[model samples]
Target chain A: SQKTINPNYSNRGMTLEEDINESNLYYLTNGIAVIHKKPTPVQIVSVDYPKRSAAVIKEAYFKQQSTTDYNGVYRGKYIDFEAKETKNKTSFPLQNFHEHQIEHMKAVVKQGGICFVLLRFTNSDEVFLLEAKHLFPYWDESIKGGRKSIPKKIIETIGYHVPIHLHPRIDYLKVIDHLYFNQ
Target chain B: SQKTINPNYSNRGMTLEEDINESNLYYLTNGIAVIHKKPTPVQIVSVDYPKRSAAVIKEAYFKQQSTTDYNGVYRGKYIDFEAKETKNKTSFPLQNFHEHQIEHMKAVVKQGGICFVLLRFTNSDEVFLLEAKHLFPYWDESIKGGRKSIPKKIIETIGYHVPIHLHPRIDYLKVIDHLYFNQ
Candidate 1:
């Protein structure tokens, strides 16, 4: 018997979320890393318990988060980061990060944890791992009448380019190993 | 004019969640540690934007998490744990923990992360920090037709009693420092 798959499903593009999830799953399965994206926070206003099964939330609102999207343990060290995708061709906008996230990253860095941002250039299909130390200067400079966005050339120079791999999709730990772990 | 305050609000007891949050905040502000409760995972089914200040989630369901409730960086090490309070005085039931959470703790342990559970006995007004290594054997025993609950006597012997404090409320990290970090 021949099974026919939906063409529309096959034609769907993989979002950054899906790609990272797949990569995290790969890392988890291989015992390489234990990073996971935090679930989207929601404020539940009301709930309805319809008979058996489970209770259904009748009303809710998406809540603002005070930290980054992803965090976990990597090689006995705390690894924390946020991932953002930009369609802009020239530079990556700083507006993608919230003030609380910046403060959170600063705290993580102060605690001697690895803190970074995974920036994806959608136009070029390139991903770069930018450290929080590098990101903070741009964030601080923006308030000091500096450029609100980081130029691509600067990112290309300072940021480590994450190689895309078949199993992990984004072999980010490879970059982390090379840059931080002296591998 | 004197402002009237509700006595009921003042008399209300603080939950375990509030206690932990307050403790984490104290830890953060004092530069002692960086720990946070992961936001409750919610599955958003529908959303509506009625030209408002914020988008409202019309329909959603609370999702079960595979990981523990709280995790963060402490002394350059990954700290992961779940906090649970029980009314039962004799023992802590294994049913409080899901299989996936057990698996998550196991993974964190394997990754050299400090993993534990903060068990609070509501009736006794006592809290204990039980390490994952201590927890795993009991969980494994349950599968082999053993007791489904960890005896309070056993927990009292194996787990370190977390001292309650005024500002932080539940200072479990102090126990962690003593037990794991040798401080």
Candidate 2:
């Protein structure tokens, strides 16, 4: 029997979370990068052992981490980044980022690692790779009553748009190339 | 009243975990490294909302992670490692490691990041920094019916013993310098 292809798959049916996960898998399968979403840290207060199969955690609490998600290595350079998506079309809000994450990116940059943000605008179906250096101004200005959002024109000027691909789906390395390698 | 001082304050009172945590904190505070123990990951199945401000997780399960305990950047180098403490003085058992963690370390190394294990023997209060490259052969041998343990003598020869100090208790970076940087 001929299988009916789901129409949603043809479009960007996947959420930003799913797309980034697919992108990481793509990187892994191609041996291009070794990035992973750091699991949400939790403090376990109690656990239950059931027949030695696997210990089950019975009581836990979410922990506040000092860093952002997705950090690893690429081409002998440390790669540390975070991904966030918003449905708004006008601008990306600075409030989406936390202070500690900004400090972490600064630390990574000071250590000479590649640091950036993967911003996805679902409304326009655009994905941008924004360098941490460009992000610093908006972060600094927001503290002094400047607009809490980064205008689309600013992102379009400074960020590289990641093209969608059939095989890898979210082929972010191509954008990384244009932004970092000038390819 | 002035606090009574014990002469043994620097001799011994802290646990192995405390020493390592203190060392990690020192590294982080000094901006030397960003490594941290990943708090246990858990899946919350139910939660009790006691008040508007408190949401307590009532039921949860431990989630198996596909990576190691500590990972971050150190001096422009991506650092991924694990720490284990054992009371046995004769040897450090191979069973202390998980298969997934070994695989994760291999991936980290392939991506040009430093991967290693920090083994502390609580009985002798000695901590050794063992590079992943040296550990791999023993892991392979264990699978081929060899002794499932890394003997103290072998560890002494191949691993650099981390010296504990008052400020930075675990000071594994000093050992890393001796092993990796040849300093």
Candidate 3:
């Protein structure tokens, strides 16, 4: 089987996460921001401490993250968000998000921290930034057995389309500056 | 040997970490702030997916944290800090901190985020809130074969004393209010 890499984002030969990480490094080195992806949460059940070697965890289990994946300070404001890439072209399924994550987003909003979701439609090679405030009502309706996903068109209209760039890859912060800071 | 609980802070039956955690929870539930302790980072080596149960990690190792233990949003300001407790009544060892963590704090401060350290002298039953900027020179000097620790009196002079409280436990935010916002 052969795979064709989309020339748009594939120029760097990176996944969405790698692109974001590289962009974050760029941000960090340039004194632009201090955002970081939190490490995967794990539950250690057993460990062995040897005499000469480092301690090894013999048994552990993955734990569902209680909060959004990425968080940090940017321009004197607290920033937090979750990023997900979907192959679905028509709509981005609500199932891509977890319940507790929504709750966490609500809390972050209440604290006046910036919160949002980054939706990458891989099939279309496009990305969008949707603020958590705009996303809440749809999530509420979703729990009441409404539309299981937000149509791509609606996302295009309501969300800020994040244009991919060479140096920073996805310029989500540019979208953020336009939306939150009136820049 | 029976552990004696000090009436001052031990009345709540919590260590410095637990006290901070309970306080964070208090702040979160009351809509005051949103802070979280980052999960301990682990390097996963192998895993097994048994069809019947949750995936189990067979081999892993604990990794040194690259940043501070705690961070979040408070009063719309980005908040980040490291907390440590010491039984040494005369001095707090600089060895308790890592180089990368200090660099991370420096970057955070440059971004205008509020960064500090919570120093709990367990034997003396005192806690102090020391800004990251104040601690940096000491760290730099220590690296150049200067004093290996910060004297307790110097800490008391430069750091704001955090009075223990029943409701919020540490009342660090109060110190932040005074120091950062001139509350």
Candidate 4:
């Protein structure tokens, strides 16, 4: 018996992370943007240094990030954003974002940076770039006895639908260009 | 015999890292800027999850960062830089910078972001913010049969001396404001 390989094996269930990372790499290589996903924060409790080699971390724990996931410079402006994916078809749950992330976004917006969330409806394979300003109202509403989720209908209306492209899988900057730069 | 505690125990002989971290925190709290030191990259080989609050990383190695250590948004612009300390009094060695960092800086500068190196001469207790534009020539020269280090006198003349203050210990943005923002 021989192993049968599926035609779409490589990309059968490509993750949102993989898509965005590929897009960022594409943007970086083309000199279009200088975006990067900040490395995962870890708290190292102990380390052992070998004689001639690098230090080996013996004990560590994952630390919660104080800021958003991805951030960088684009066209002389600061770009900050968080990327999230949901399996639900109807709405994106508010639980995906932390209070600290919201605060970080608020700070980023306060400092004149473009802040947004790249929300992916994994089931639908649709992506949207929702601005931080739009997110705040919903986030605040949730805290004050409002709906705990943003309906897909409202997101479809308010958020720019990001199209997936060949070179850049998720061409989010195209949406940003249209929304911010008008070009 | 009782151990005598020095009055300047906390402040005396503070490393450049401590000064910058304090300054960044101050800037963040004051809403002046949103700068952060990127977390140290770690390549986790094993993780142990014992049905606890957090996953513990058991075995990991420090990963070399592909980009600079510090980056953030400041006054609607992308700010990116690396902080380095040198004990040598006469010159700043070119070997301190990796090729990847130089490439990253070049990419950032090309994208119209503010890029620089925060260099500290520990012996002299002096710090300088040397712009990426000024650094490239010396970097290129070193590759083309030129001096492997930038002389102290040259750095003193070209780079902006970052003044240490009470609130923000290493007030580097002040130099940026003077150089780039015309404030």
Question: iRMS for all predictions?
Answer: 1.0, 2.0, 0.7, 0.8
lDDT of 4 by residue, A1-183 (tens): 111222332233778888889999999999999999999999999999999998999999999888999999999899999999999999999989999999999999999999999998887677889999999999999989899999998998889888676658888998899888997
Residues A8-122 of candidate 3 have per-residue lDDT tens digits of 6543446788878877888898889999989999999999999999999999999988999899999999999999989899999999999999999999998889999998888
Chain B TM-score for the candidates in order = 0.90, 0.87, 0.93, 0.91
Candidate 4, position B162, lDDT? 81
Per-prediction tally of clashes: 0, 0, 0, 0
Candidates 2 and 4: which is better by DockQ? 4
Q: In candidate 2, what are the lDDT values of residues B115-159, reduced to their tens digit?
A: 999987777677788999899999989989998999988998888
- Winner of 1 and 4 under DockQ: 4
Q: Model 2, residue B135: displacement in angstroms? A: 0.3
Stretches of model 4 off by over 4 angstroms after superposition: A1-11, B1-11
List the candidate 2 regions with Cα displacement exceeding 4 Å: A1-11, A43-59, A178-183, B1-15, B47-55
Best TM-score goes to which candidate? 3
Q: Residue B53 in model 1: shift from native, Å?
A: 5.4
User: Per-candidate TM-score, first chain only?
Assistant: 0.91, 0.87, 0.92, 0.92
- DockQ (CA atoms), all models: 0.65, 0.50, 0.83, 0.75
Question: Per-residue lDDT tens digits of candidate 1, residues A1-183?
Answer: 111223332312577778889899999998988999998888888998888868788778787788999999989889999999999999999989899999999999999899999998887677888999999999999978888999988998888877776667777898789878899
User: Which portions of model 3 miss their true places by more than 4 Å?
Assistant: A1-7, A11-13, B1-8, B11-13
- For model 4 the local lDDT of residue A68 reads 94
Clashing pairs in 4: none
- Best candidate (score: DockQ): 3
